[model samples]
Target chain A: MLFHVLLLITFIIVILIYEWKHYQGRDRYVFVMLFALASIYLLAAIVDWRIPEYVQGVDFLLSPLKKPLQAWLDQFQI
Target chain B: MEQKISSIQFTVLVFMNTLGTAIIFIPTIATRYGRENGWITVIFATLLGMVFILWLTTLIGQEDDTNFFKIMDNRVGKLISYCLILLMVSFIFFTTFANIWSIAQFVSLQILMGTPPQVLALISTFTGLIAVRYGLEVIVRSAEIFFPFTMLSLTLLALLVWPEAQLIRVQPVMQLNQAATFVGVLPVIALTYMELIVMLVVLPHVNDLRQAKKAFLIGGGLAGFCIIIVTFAAIAVLGVDGTVRHAYSIYVLGQNIQIAEFFERIEVLVAFIWFITIFFKVSTCFYFLSIALQHMLKVKNYHSLTVPLGMILLATAMTNLPNIFYDFEMMNSTYLILSYITGLTVATVLSLAMLIRKYKEKVK
Candidate 1:
């Protein structure tokens, strides 16, 4: 988790520098934020603590959606 | 605003784009009709893409220096053209969403069980957004770098799986009905190749469009070869029941192999290889989406639209997907048909009507 956080910090700093350099009028800032977001997300994923909770949440959200949609397509069964 | 990609780069890009996730689904798709004709379905479907390559490239070539949006302006009138352009953007958005989230499902299931699908989707979207920011030039270059490694890993796996391959698995070759084979190929035809229509934007910019066409054919051939060999290997080892049940049959095959007892459970290496494919795939879609957004919105810089567009795709993936099983059902049943039929023929005629008008305008 610390490694992910450190990587995220490093990427955020890099993005800040790249954005500052955006004064020169290149599009480097887009890529910079991209990496930064990627790093933060990776960090969160590594540190994900609520898997059981998230799993249940997903089931709650999806069950209503999945079953009927499947039923709607029963006629098209192949 | 960017320069055209060379034929070789386009070659690798198309290959990386076409080769993903198609391998695993072949048996599933084929089983619906017949097993013997699985390879035949790939052939027929690939031929449809190949034909589209000829006609779509030629149609765009007539507009010399034209891209999809410009062609749309001439081919279709402004209002309808704008609507179609929006549809194209949404199409790319939805397809990218499915692909992005599926990668998550795969990682969670095959590599890191219980890893949140959102985690993979988020990482992949961010990585894709970065690639989108770089534009096509960097994407083409990165594809070159990853191309060799993807080939090497796939080859090594195919080689390893050869030992356990049973010749009997492919026997009873005529088990599938000849009449149903052509119909069986529809999903592949529609999904894999129909998406090539999206390449209409990238077509005119290809250096030596003929060579680009050739590269498309070659890349497709390479994919088909990989499909046949891998399918054959799967059948040889797992037979129909085992192959059908196995989600990551190739990865399963990889794990099942001994390779001097040192190479057991090496599917993670392959999971990484697929990571590379997903990288190129998402980037390609994101890049195209950016360009299309620029054209549609008349933005001077595509980079500005990248974040919002990525957000939209993320939303599309998040909305209504519900779970991995639905995602697979969508990909296998709905998406393939949509991409093949709706993507190829329906979209083609719509665009072609626009192309014809453009050609007449140029002629006049």
Candidate 2:
């Protein structure tokens, strides 16, 4: 876990240096915020947070529709 | 100087986009739903898809040298255009993640066993980042160069597998399930033609509008034909049961090839075609997502965001898709619905908006 975290930080640092050299003002700030959010998300995933479960929740809610849709679609079968 | 791609290059892009991941999954989906009559679903979808392309090109041609986002801004107001743009960006984001996750799953299962999916996802996303960093012309040129080899390999796969194909496997042609066969058209259309809606983001960069439209139809037709041949080959060679059994049916079909028993197990070579096509698809989606972000944030350089966006993509793919079964479930249910809502529905609304604006202009 530490290795992964360090890897993520290193990637962000390299990208930040490149951005700092090439971009300024709003672009750099936006890129920083975006990169930070993405890094947090990756960190969350590495730690086995409930982040993925929320996505699976979508499937759980939509599961009811699948059977009916399948049945309806199966009606087209000769 | 502005970068421009030729119509031929545009056609290759379209071809690559339409084939995308559909090349890997279409045979199984078609045979599963349509049974032995899967090829019929492809043909029907292709015809409908052509009409769709016609409407799309006409809508695009009505404008000058502007992309779909700009067209939306002109026809509709800023508020609605931004909403539409957000929807497109979301669609592109999910699609890109799906592609990355797919390649990761494939590599993990087939080639590099026991490798973590996140690592595989990182590799795929990083490649996409490099491609998007270079911009569209470089991406299109790469596709143009790879198109012939991809096609040649596909043709060879079809021809080499033909001797093993039996007519009896696909026997009761069109007689089994008419309703099911017609319904099967949805997934194929959703995966191939509907997904081509992303091309609207890059259409304005083509050198000639008239030729771009022609290339659009030809590219779509060629992709449809390749899909048909593959579906037929899988069914006739593997039988309907065999085709639907494997997740990557095309790879299994490639494994069936043998030249005097010495030249066998060439599934890796067959898998290479998919790798090339899916890379273009992932890169195109990433590129579209970046452009959409640049327009939305009013950024001076889209290049600056590629690395960050690619990171987000990698993270999202790893988080959302936990396993191959989850990926399959999402593709069949959520992803299918999302493609229709974002892709076809958006295209239809934009076409209507274009017509209304044109009619209002004529009155003025």
Candidate 3:
């Protein structure tokens, strides 16, 4: 977790540095995407703080992939 | 920001990048079919990999300069270039993402079983993005510095286990059947060389055209050697049954190492090395994607693409992969085909076409 946060901070800083040096219209969309990513990280952090320990809403966003993997895991333990 | 890396650095980077992930899986997967004869398939795939490299080199060598995407643009058309770019992006994107996903799963399986693999992935993504943000020069430099140690440590590990490693494990050499060894090595051949596709983005940055083809063969050979040694050791020590049963066989080998019983738990050292090598692998791919994105969208500032590409890669990694086994299966089947067959074939055809074009111009 500490490791991830530091990387994210570094990433955000790199983008800002790049934008400051070469601000242009075409690059704006990229910054927009960065901002959205930052928001997801922030939101995920918030969810970790408020939600029940086992209940993760993010995993559902990837339900299609999770089902089969879970089924494979179940083969061993279930 | 792209400094010209020598043929050695390029070769080392590829070997270090591909060897880490494959060594852990190769023995077990190979044993699933070939038993001891699995090593033979490894040799076969490696030789074939060289053939792929020679062909890829032949293509890149044409015209004194030009990269894959550019060749596609010229040979096919602008629209086709766009399609090729899109395909390349998806290839790098999914493979990079899938690697992250598996690394997380490996962590979860090995330690921190309760923690979501997502957390480990996020850590890797951020580290990878930062590495890519600085550009390929930094990534290549660090990989060069570490590549030798990566191979050395793996060799040292095998040496330590030699005393206890069972010869009978890989014995009767095809007890499992030839299909297993063939299956085991073939997929890895594809995925590792799929990484050669990194050249599509990185080649244009090469200052010397002379070193291009040499780099691929050298790298492929080194990586091939590393894979063979690790897979052979795993079979020799753990045997086919143990190899087949263990998910990350190499790491498991570390767990059993008892150098007078004092040097135990050093598997942490192995894991740390795994972390660094895999990080290098992920960052290299991430950096290339950002570079390619800049070229595709005509973005003036290539740096801006780093975070956005990183985010998409991470998010896609977390979602596009449903679970670990399915991802493994895909790497085994479809994705394998794309990297080895499609990637190698297209590189051969495109380069041949480019060479023919150059010859005609010179003759006229």
Task: Please report the candidate that would top lDDT against the real structure.
Answer: 2
Error of 1 at B187 (Å): 1.6
Please provide, for model 1 over B156-209, each residue's C-alpha lDDT reduced to its tens digit, 9 standing for 90 to 100. Answer: 777877888877776767664665566656556545666666666666677787
Candidate that scores best on DockQ = 2
Chain A: TM-score in each model? 0.42, 0.65, 0.36
lDDT (10s digit) by residue, model 3, range B1-364: 3256666667767676766566666655555546676666677778877787676666554443334465566775787567667666766776687778778888987877888887788888989988877777777788888876776787778688787777666677655455545555556576665566765555555656567566767777877777777778777877767766777877877777788968875566567657767887788778767766777877777677776666666665665566766666565544654455447556765766677777999999
Q: Considering DockQ, which of the candidate structures 2 and 3 is the better prediction for this target?
A: 2
Among the numbered candidates, top TM-score falls to 2
Better of 1 and 3 by DockQ: 3
DockQ value for model 1 = 0.08
lDDT of each prediction vs. the true structure?
0.66, 0.83, 0.67
Total residue pair clashes for candidate 3: 6
Clashes of each: 5, 4, 6
Q: Which of the predicted structures, 1 or 2, would earn the higher TM-score when compared with the native?
A: 2
Kept native contacts, as fractions per model, are 0.03, 0.51, 0.17
- Expressed as tens digits, the lDDT of each residue in A1-78 for candidate 1 is 686568656755765665454433334445445445544444444565332322234335455554664464333224
| Model 3 stretches astray by more than 4 angstroms | A1-22, A33-78, B62-68, B174-176, B340-342, B355-359, B362-364
Give the TM-scores of the predictions, in the order they appear: 0.78, 0.95, 0.81
Q: What does DockQ give for each predicted structure? A: 0.08, 0.50, 0.14
Checking candidate 3 for backbone clashes, the offending pairs are A65-B322, B33-B180, B34-B181, B59-B351, B165-B237, B169-B239
Where does candidate 1 clash, by residue pair? Answer: B75-B354, B166-B236, B190-B339, B190-B340, B191-B340
